[model samples]
Target: MKSEFQSHEPDEPFLSRVQRVLTDLSPAERRLGEFLLDFPGELGSYDAQELARLCDVSKATVSRFIRRIGFESYDKAKKAVRDERATGSRAFFAHAEPEANAAALALDMREEKDNLDRTFGKLNAGELDDLARAVLSSRKVWIAGQRISFSFAHYLFWQLTKIVPEVVVFPQGGETLGEHVARIQKGDLVIAIMLRRRVAGTKRLLDAILEAGAELALISDESMARHADARWHFHCHTHSDGPQFNHAAVLALCHQIVVRATLQSGREGRERLRAVDAVNEKLLQVEW
Candidate 1:
């Protein structure tokens, strides 16, 4: 007789399969499940014995968990994870235990340095120049980011506005995001900073921007690299050492883009800075 576990949908992701079996899982199985959910790509990196060791379970338990999730064997489950990753799954797995005290401080610095190195190592100069030129020549530029990503949007907007004409960072106090997105017209450029597990409606907003005839540029982390819909997409490294996601690479990219845009704007940028400075001086906005 054929097994019922074989009835699972072939296209379902490993994480989703684990989630489906969550209620039926034992405490040890659930622990393994949670880890796998967070780090599915790691599944491809370890065998049944290694996975069981990492999860603090017996090899038999790992085999059972694999079967429970509809895989006939542990190896088969591992291969599924590998296949999913090749197809662009959101799995940037850093299998590290949480550090504490002095060790945590060192880990933080090391991870941030790694993030910066990896992000810029893969940076494309041609894409950067094209994006900068698009911003410089755009009739209007709109910037938007949700959750913690809003910081990047605000910083880019703050710097770019000083040198570029008609630059806007949207969803300011008393404004709806939809209202701003709706105003995206032809010849406009929209830069959206969407990081891991992007805010709801982000994809829809990108689609809406495109439908409205605006060019969309996505500035996101690797998790969104394969999924984001945009005319131009830039990925920033966001590996973190602590419990929270880091933003160092994203900020660095923002800084680079701002510098590039300023350079592309040339004399217009200098004049804009001078004009803003004169206004600041006249209005006593800065103390001498």
Candidate 2:
């Protein structure tokens, strides 16, 4: 009988190729792929030792598996996986026609609502209040995110600036991340947003912030929660519409945080609004 686990043909579908390669893999390689397929979110965040421990394999086995998958090292394999996920996510969303994808989007929306409900049920009021107070009192606030997460960070930065004196959104991929992090004082707060597929640069920034002794407010999926050293952490549950792409639930969480912050700032926020209106009124009189 012909082997069912043949090398993938050039024209083969991605999922089919994945399945074929998985079937052809040695037992150890198969275990590793199974681990990745079963918990892509978890595997995305795990180190080699952690992955090996979870998969009940040795570190050498993990290394061998990585090499078998055509990556020279574990880090390279992880990076490949991340890139594949990002590309797959973008492709899925790009191909989706609003009318044709409506049912799928609706399903996603419903799932997001259920996640929000569960999160609210489990949220600690006192912790939220403390986080709000920290935001209100911090001398400076730094918001950082990459890719899809950049939108969430930008939204929070905008809202926080309305009520707070100093707020900055860290730009995407600069050579000066370390220098920027160096400027954070003890009273500063860093709000970092990352999701299932956390960006490497974002993680590096988070680490730098921790070393600088800045307080952290982390908003991420549950799988990435361990990576952040947050004084307060909010886990946004997201379900994958395909093999990749998970952002809707995170955007909802961002909205929730901004709304909560606005409510907590009340009078201060109103006063700032008045100030902004006055500035806008004067600025509107001038034409470009």
Candidate 3:
């Protein structure tokens, strides 16, 4: 049928490909495409017959839509969408309409649950162990995150500094980020939290960290998957149930990282914790 989807470059985003074919599709096909376009995540959950019923289109139109999108069959189209979706691509989040009242909370819970499942499912055990080892052995661990992500970075930094010596968080008060980058030694590790609406200059900052001979680690949402330089890349899912984005998955992932690092620290970690407790007691940091 010489559909517009056929002209897409191999690397182009599937969402963009769908958009390109929007005007070329018949009325029924366009309706189905638009529905899937708005609820791209649903593509993973619905079969052709079910989707046809939901979109008020016939089975033939569903089959035609699959081919129009450059897939050989309905199953293949669904698989492609699911694969792209698993990456936590921004397209799925872009058009996810906000809900109201109790529906919003219900949706939030559902989406957050899915986030944890998908994120933990994809995590590699060996890679996690390697990150823990890096934390325990590095001369200094430099952590950086801006905006909302800074909260996660701060929590991780707070936990890590108590267990490991020489942990630094960048842009402390009057100091600049570049100053911190300059302090990174060859054996140091840099953990960066870069989620959606990525901070300007983040890639450049990571580059600077790498150029300074420090190993780079990334804790980010699927949108940042293309970052090839990270020694360890942990991608989390951040789908929100409402108008705002959800961060529960990111927090859970960070918690796991801290737990692993603590376990890897072994006797040294226990000694450090005891020392911290002694100081806390003397300083009356925690009220009884």
Better of 1 and 2 by TM-score: 1
Please name the candidate that would achieve the greatest TM-score relative to the true structure.
1
C-alpha RMSD for every candidate: 5.2, 11.2, 7.5
The candidate with the higher TM-score, 1 or 3, is: 1
Residue-by-residue lDDT tens digits, candidate 3, 191-256: 989987776787788888889999988998876655787889998988764446778889998888
Candidate 1 residue spans exceeding 4 A from truth? 1-101, 227-229
Question: lDDT of each prediction vs. the true structure?
Answer: 0.81, 0.68, 0.80
TM-score of each: 0.67, 0.62, 0.66
**What does the lDDT come to for candidate 3?**
0.80
Q: Is candidate 1 or candidate 3 better by lDDT?
A: 1
Clash pairs (backbone) in predicted model 3: none
Can you write out model 1's per-residue Cα lDDT over 13-127, one digit (the tens) per residue? 7778888988778899888888888767667878889888878888888887888888887788878887776544346344434443245457448878888999999889888
Clashes of 3: 0
**Candidate 2: segments with Cα more than 4 A from true spot:** 1-108, 172-175, 242-246, 285-288
Q: Ten residues in a row with the worst lDDT in model 1?
A: 92-101
Clashes of each: 0, 0, 0
